[model samples]
Target: MTGIALPSLPAEVVDQAIDWSIKLTYNRADASTMTAFDAWLASHEQHRQAWERVQSLGGRFAGMPAELALQTLEKLPEARLRRRQMIKLLSLFAAVGVGGMGAREVTPWQRLLADHSTQVGERGRWTLIDGSVLDLNTDSAVVLRFDESQREVELLRGELHLISGADAGSPGKRPLRVATAFGLFEALGTRFSVRLDQHGCRLGVSEGAVRLTPRDGTARVAQAGESWSLSAREATRGTATPQEVAAWRDGLLVARDMPLAEVLAELGRYRHGHIGCDPQISTRPISGNFNLTDIDATLDFLAQAHGLRLNYLTRYWLRVSV
Candidate 1:
């Protein structure tokens, strides 16, 4: 349920709730402790309600990799959590999703209510009102803002493969732009793909050209067959093959001597939880065509091909080691 649906309880009840959470999570509660907790719960309806909220707060940890989840929770400000853990409970009143609670992701309202969005391990497409086709890759969000003046798409996260459509009424008069946190991608009759993450945005142009204007006010042009690494201030040109650019769209990952760590990171995009690489073998070069939709097959392939080991800490946590 949304936070608005949950009523507020007293501060003391909330404190007890957090205390119970820490004890149960970090300590083995003896029979006496359980008995005491039960009696406490029975003593006041607010206590029971607060305990329920505490449990619900952990709901976001469900299905998360054990280590990743624990690490994220550990990153929570210790003093802040101890003092206001109840309010910090994502289920209680956090406006953002669990992603923001501790995982450090930004889920803006624009992305939350985007015209087109997809979850992890999901791929989808949408035909905009003006007939443009947008293919969204896993864990992606894109918002389309089209009006009488222009056609605009804002990519909040993940990646997008866009095929611009003509403005049937007056194609010449309509201008199209794709905006990211760092800058703008102005379409010049092009087909392009864009991926965004903590580092910045990676853009590949397949046909025609794109003019990018970074937040720092520098402008650069990327033509066909060229890829650009765009950060907040500038765009650097690079090489990209069509197959390399379009592989994920066809449910495949194309690696051309990419680092094992890089490959694992790319594959992690399609799988939930953590796909970790041992520091010992992360620099190993890996090159192959891998299926994107079958994560198990990919993992199996990695193990068999590279003589690596897959250690499953939990269904949600995996460690690849040599």
Candidate 2:
């Protein structure tokens, strides 16, 4: 048996080539349509080497269920998945050359959403078309889709802070809407924070107003400097100051005599691990401002001031005890 000789490609160049090839494959291409691609490839030895590295990138799709692959790829950590795909493709290219070119078709939305999730402990700020801005907190995921009729954002997971944009040109433009686990929040040209926690959903209005309609019949209107929680049964509204609601944006978590357990829950969102109060300390009162960026220092401060002890089982797990 005769084996095809493959050219040596630098690791970086090979990676770029595989990425481009995967993109092209998803865009739709087959083995026989390589006339122009071959010409382009031969234009430079580097290009040829790159193409060689990328041609076999889709072997993972072989005999693998397309739906499973798509879902698995979507859930895998982006960096690690991409690296593995690149390595697989490069290996095939080195073994079989450009003759192997069977790649699965993945939709653009799947690719886009798969690429846009936030990293752990990382927050992001983005601007919308209507001039309003959005701040995504750590470990959050959102999908933005705009059309001629309306602008919509789907909160797939995690939390987001939205500042509604005023009507720019169209007087009766469709109102900006945010969909989440709690329900749908319709902004009345308002600024608010929407968070999804294990228990339920929380909304804190900073400026303007917001209308909350739950999956159930319960509904409520939240005004400036107000907060609300929506659950499966009902919506609860309360008066909360703007400073307290917006504190996280400035890298601080401020609690005003809140229960120790609740404060630990909020702090856990900004950290990589489980942060919980000891059963004995669950009812303790927690106050003062804690830095969101430095969880360790904040924990240390809590220990020094309140006689709480910081305990760590792993880098990703934390607990507070007597």
Cα TM-score per model: 0.69, 0.61
Candidate 1 whole-model C-alpha lDDT, 0 to 1: 0.71
TM-score of 1: 0.69
- Ten-residue stretch with the least lDDT total in model 1: 96-105
Give residue 316's lDDT in candidate 1 (0 to 100).
47
Cα lDDT of model 1 by residue, 200-263, tens digit: 7888888889999888869999988888888898998877675597789999999988877778
Candidate 2: C-alpha RMSD to true structure equals: 16.9
For residues 1-322, could you state the per-residue lDDT of candidate 2 as single tens digits? 1255555556665565565554444432222222234334435678655653344234444454545655554443322335465455544433333333422222224235732456556788987777778887766778876676776777765677888776485556777877776687888878998877655678888888888888775778888888988776678875667667777778888898977777776776665434554555666888898898987788888889998877763454355767
Error of 2 at 45 (Å): 65
